[model samples]
Target: MVQGHYESLNRKNDERMNAIPYCDTGEVFEADTIANVWKREDKEWLKRTQSDRSGYEYPRLGESPYINMTDDFRMEKKVICQDIFWSCDGTSFVSVHNDFGIRQYLVPEESNTDKLNRNLLLPFTRFFRNQSIVSCAIDPFYTLYNENSDRLAGDRIVVGGKNFPLQLYSLMDGQCILSYDTMNKINGEYETVYSVKIDVESRVYTGSCRNKVAIYDKSRRDAVWMNQSTKKASKGRQSIISCFEEQPMGGQALSRGSLLCGSYANEMFQVDCRHQRLERLNYTRTVAGGIVQILTSDNGRYVYVVRRNSDAISIYDRRNLQHELNVLRLPFRIHHNSAKLKAYIDTAYGLSMGTPQGTILNWGRDLVEFGGVPSHNSVDDPLITSIPPESEWRTNLSSTIPATVVKNCPGDPELFALSHGGTISLCRFGG
Candidate 1:
């Protein structure tokens, strides 16, 4: 593997340590079926892509198509817009624009088909560029519904960066059911809503990059208990590096935290969610780093994160920040593979993805597959990758195909959602 010799904190920084071994779930995910993927890239259409170099190219469609990566994953579709809602029944979908517009469609299933089942939906989208909708939540916000035909979506939503504009949506038609712009009400607090999560009891929890926290109940829809900013104790700037939802969904209580942004020269701290606030927990393999992306398992079994400047992924126990599970490092040689090369690490349990510029090394703990799509800048070949390849246990939620290419499989409720741009993939790991 490319990553090894992690520095030790028990002593001075430069003290190297050996990697510890870990165990896999040993169960394979499966796929009952596959379907075409479609998406709009960065708001624009992209070049066609395929598994085969000479494979057919994909194209853009106006109507809402269920780019099902697999049967279990959420549908993958882009608004060709921002501040929009895209939802589908088994065969068709309705697209709602933020300017109060809507469109319906039955997309063609073949790459060669250009005609869209236009007017499939009524009230076309009145989308306008740069509408001020979201104040915090990341682009491509994750939307959820209680069921397939529920006209109203999002009983609860994780909005804003965390709570700048805590807006709730009525998925039935992308209606703004509620807007709790908490920052305006804060007592002159420096708020950068980093992350927000929902609980079953209809309460909202907002986490800010500045180490501040707020919890609101749906009954009140008001920021009842606001924890003072954590940085109030220090005279320095702190960034809410990253945020995520804690495990065990659907309780009256809410618990979540973030990694403060700064130089990776220090260890990351796990927030206690409430007044215990931010606790310092640095890696003995000291790199002085903060959090990157926070990826949690569906069941919240493991919380995985990639540390800064290092290509390694850290496994944490998530429950109480008890101990570090493993540090997975990809190899340099694998990443150095020739351009136009593709590497995939598909095991019974998981699949590691790489672009043309990167590599996928480390099966158990070392470089196994080499090279990813070369440099995200220099585009040679558009790589289409899928994870937890449609096995019996996980076939529903993973597929990554470029949108321009139209192919078909005989299935419905497509579990896979296309990536929306370079790779029209609607795939992911799901229950």
Candidate 2:
């Protein structure tokens, strides 16, 4: 199954090369104007600029111009990035650093010369002292223009921090729009919010912490429902709900109060936020490992659960939670400290995972045929396929840089993977 997979040789070739050929244009042009026409060297240029403006040059054809290079974006930081999220349009992405600073980068519309020059293009960055952003969610309903007045109202980003208030910021300027105190004394004092999800249409947000989950309604400017427990037994069994995801049904414009969450108690459950009390649709306890993350299919039919520090993932059918459809195991151990488990299931790529070993593994849907059968020898099971030497879809990053997040770019064949060391790689499959 791994045959025909290709690994990008751009990085390897970049290290052994020194200089690229270029046509030195004697005239100078503005940086923006030069960047606009840098790709077309064959076109006639009518210079209307002074020599001191900025000397410009264009790469000749067949010279392996840097503009044709595939290595899109890369950045280095003093600390490992905590999390990275792509915008709804896939044109930009935001990454959070351990030092409570947030950096947003624009996905270059055109390829660039080098990583340093690419980053020096002035990305949007903001820092918050004494506040470490734990989770962030982009408002799905936000648009550039107001519906009523046709005026511009910028998009908003919701962010949660450790022991800090849940704050909303303008996506354009990083200015605070609103803030809510999420710390609750009833569930467990000093409990920090670890997860947050926003229902943009409803203008409501859900936050999960140590032993409680709170739903804040933007219209009311207060929590509509806050679940907190005071019982001793509840506290003992209570586990932090580290992950929360809204599973919007098919044909629904917005999520209809249905949410899926994973807890440290080794359980995966669904919650309905319409009611005042905690109402569950389905709950199941899986393997001994804690539930690290929960992901749903585009149709909301299948649920994939990632286990912390475990090599296996449990897949369940949403209609029937009595038993898991299948339990698929990986070849290597996953990083326990990794906050997010990147998984995507689509027709083109059945199911792909970015592992801690810096490899993207594709476990196609063919394994589902082995369901309901117990294998006598786990190692020799036909369902378990190892990474082969050559596959058209597999990519092996450096062993030192573990891929913390992997996401597919919309309307394109590209897959973006962010490493633990703050490096982002763009890979094209089946091209």
Say which candidate scores most in TM-score.
Answer: 2
Candidate topping lDDT: 2
**Could you give me the TM-score of model 1 versus the true structure?**
0.45
lDDT: worst 10-residue window of model 1: 20-29
Model 1: lDDT of residue 161: 33
What is the lDDT for 133 in model 2?
67
Cα-lDDT of candidate 2: 0.49
Misplaced by over 4 Å in model 2 are 1-77, 112-122, 142-154, 183-191, 200-203, 228-238, 246-257, 280-287, 338-341, 345-350, 364-396, 413-417
lDDT for 166 in candidate 2 is 77
TM-score of 2: 0.66
For residue 273, give model 2's deviation from the true position in Å: 2.7
lDDT of 2 by residue, 48-161 (tens): 212226675422222212234334221111344566555545566665655454555556453445432332122333333345567777655444333645422426677776
**What does the lDDT read for residue 152 in candidate 2?**
27
